[model samples]
Target: MGRELLNFKMFLSVLFAFTVGYAIITYGRLVREEIGRYDRALSERVQVIERVKAKPITVKGLYLTASSAASSRTRQRIIELIKETELNSVIIDIKDYTGNILYDSDLDLVNQLDTERVVMREVKEIINEFHNADIYVVARQTVFQDPALAQAQPEWAITTEGGGLWRDYKGLSWVDPTKPEVWQYNFAVAREASKLGFDEINFDYVRFPSDGNIRTAVYANLEGSKAETMRKFFKTLDESLQRSRVYTSLDLFGMVLESGDFDLNIGQTLAVALDTVDYICPMTYPSHYPTGHLGLANPADHPYIVVSNGLKKSQTAFAKAERTQLRPWVQAFNLGAVYDGPKIRAQITAIEEADRTSGWMLWNASNNYDSRGLLPDEHAAALRSDVTT
Candidate 1:
């Protein structure tokens, strides 16, 4: 009996040892898996933070449409222009007035909407090339003027009194600016652009429709005055984009600078823009100004006087703003007067003379820019170096 008891005790000891060993092994495996998951999540968060923290560049840029950027030949010519001239940046259309997304997007909603036109198939490669050339690239996104989105998601669109999609004078449909979903959609695009390595995201047409029959158009979600609603939108945009850490700019009508508190009934004001964005790009194209502007019979005819006077009028407000810088878009395409080298130079001179202004961007719809008004490559390089030093 004593021997039997001793053997039974030994067997029980062995069972306990095996059980303890198995439990330890299982626990260790679970702990390792948890640790691995934590590490991966932390790594991903770090990457996102790093990716979005691009420094703002002093941009002397030219606009390139999606078509121009997609065409290899045209893109090469534009790059050549940048290399030869003082141009250090290029604004490429990520989304245009047609509301077509120019690149393949990973977002499910974007895919579901079928908005990816894929004009720039090699978008990442293209951005890499620009980065290789030491050129900053900006993603231009047109919000609120998206006809495609309006068509795809009519509930989020501005409607006519007849319960149809409201069309602007150009017969283009627009999304309702008051819709939060629309805001999120645009923010998603901006985030994607940031991921794609754009140094900045420029929001254009961020306003209510201006050229349509205003009396007929209806906004179901509009909560306040046009300007107040717009201010809220700007605030939301700033907050949403802060996590991405990418530089943001808003394109405003140049008249906003001189208009003061008046929002032009399109819901944009210089004061609000200054408070919201890293940069405020007033579309100060002189041709767009009225004939009597600045006491000039034709404001576009005098590029220097128009730009200088407009910028000067806003200098006080710009000076007071702690954030944001003025970067006006000068006319490069001919409208009021033929824009030649001297004409372009005059606009540049005006920008340079303005206080609290950063740099200027040339606006030509054709993307046809030359070295006429721009400095030589070496001169611009030297100037940039001097500023940095």
Candidate 2:
């Protein structure tokens, strides 16, 4: 009887062991299958993200300040304008002249420096809204004229002769252009902008300080002439951004187009800029031109002549460039003269008449766009058809 009982116990123990082992094996298989399913789902998600492509359009755009971009009413108005008119693009300020990033940034330095103001908290959503409307979005980033960066990294700033931070005419501090760190910072911003779904990155204030106490400002690391330094910077920017999906553009002074290799001491020349960027956006505001420009007493009064002549000169200057196209920033504000529909249309006509221009962007600091000068959607479509034909 004792032997029989002991045998029964051993049998029971064996059965329990087998049951436990089978359960473990089954759970392992289930876990592996679940993991495989998750991997496939993740891959599909990545593919979907990668499939989103920017719509190609001849960008007739308007500039929006960060504040205006963030405001719902302003944004709606701008969208309505685009839907009603020939405009197909919007340029929002990612980084403005004040050197504050308009949205939250993931960069360690940007965070550490506390430079971001979070003006546009829903930047991605904003971009998506524009995309939904079939509008191309461009991020305008002001380089070098970064007061925030200069304050945070004073060692990298353009210093005054007395060793204080040099201030521009507007009392804005700037980072030294020659510093590699400055280049890397701006590159990182551009990369972030591209990742955020901006179709283009428009870099402004790329040159050395154009206005300020010139004699007192000292650049510690400047090696070559200002023009050469600017050229090198442009080449570096091109190399850094070449593989990026977003297009690149530079905001050049209008005079650069007619300067004939003279850099205006701001390190901007048309030829080099044309070769470096996908688009060269000359600020061709007739109001900004001095008296006697284009043989006119007031260039602002003759918008057609100023724009046509400037663009004509630019076309000649960059006629050989294969990649870059002209997309100028024309005046939309009343600075020197009242710019009504006729004046605005004059500028648009000038751009359309150019031999190689891709488009034009209107600049009004107030973010108030006058749609009278713009063609209706149907008219614009017909115009596009004619051009294509």
Candidate 3:
């Protein structure tokens, strides 16, 4: 009987030892996983804190194409112009019409695009140069008209009835607005631009392809109307950028001011846009206006009247909103009428007459600006006198 008891004691000792060993192994793994999760959460918190906000300012700016900024001579000339005139800001293309990124971004998502294209070797240096001259810098990114992105990720492109990627009249492809990836990609670029110290991030081509075949096109993932999609995009982008300091602006069709909530069938309208973004930029280039616009024989022929009326219509539409500011894109190129110095000034004058003070941007595709209209009369006189001397 004593021997039997001894054998039973040995069995209990072995069982207890095995149970203790199993518990130690399982508990250790759980503790390690908990530590890893804690580290990841802390890292994310740090990333959120790192993004700084852009300084707010009233911008009277000029658009700069990627090549214009890449050239040393062009950049110097732009700097001189900014110093000489009442100009305080420049909107440089970070992602242009071709959807090519102009600068290298460290973000993983941008890495794929950057590998295919990079326009500037010294973006930060140029921005610092502009800042030193007291010029505010804005990063202009084209949102939906991204041919490169469409080509790279075909699933993200707009689909046709034939189950193929739809191409606009210009043969340029566009991403569907419904894709969350599309929104995320554009916002990621803006986030990186904000990190580069852009005072504001301006989005252009935020609309759908107005040139594509309308009836056969299919928005595979869109759950609502075009205007609603764009409004959601604007709101989502705005909310996403809340952690950053850079201001948000959207470029809209000049006629959006006159169209009410119709959205031009491209998903952007003045009313919904006003409630979402920080600044509303209507491409108020006189040449872009249609004949009989505002009851004029040719709206382009009357720059002051066209611009002033557009802003007034916009003001009447959103008189209650205080969040979004109105800044119009004026003509610097001679597309319809003679956009001389006086003609350019007409648009600025119109902005003032309309009692909108958000300031304006000059859009000259070639970057050749005649400063006659921008300078005050006294300044122009002094400039002429100095030249003679």
- For candidate 3, lDDT tens digit of each residue in 127-188? 88888987899999998888888888888888788988888989888888899989998888
Please say which candidate is ahead in TM-score: 1 or 2: 2
**TM-score of the candidate numbered 2?**
0.90
Evaluate residue 164 in candidate 3 and report its C-alpha lDDT on the 0 to 100 scale: 89
Q: What's the TM-score of each model vs. the native? A: 0.87, 0.90, 0.83
Clashing residue pairs in candidate 2 are none
* Pairs of colliding residues, candidate 3: 53-245, 54-245, 54-246
Most TM-score-accurate candidate = 2
lDDT of 2 by residue, 211-314 (tens): 89978889877887788888899999999987678889999998888898898988889766767888999999998899988678999999999988888887
Candidate ordering by lDDT (highest first): 2, 1, 3
Which rank order by TM-score, best down to worst? 2, 1, 3
List lDDT for all candidates, in order: 0.89, 0.89, 0.84
Task: Return the lDDT, model 3, position 257.
Answer: 84
| Residue 182 miss distance in model 1 (angstroms) | 1.0
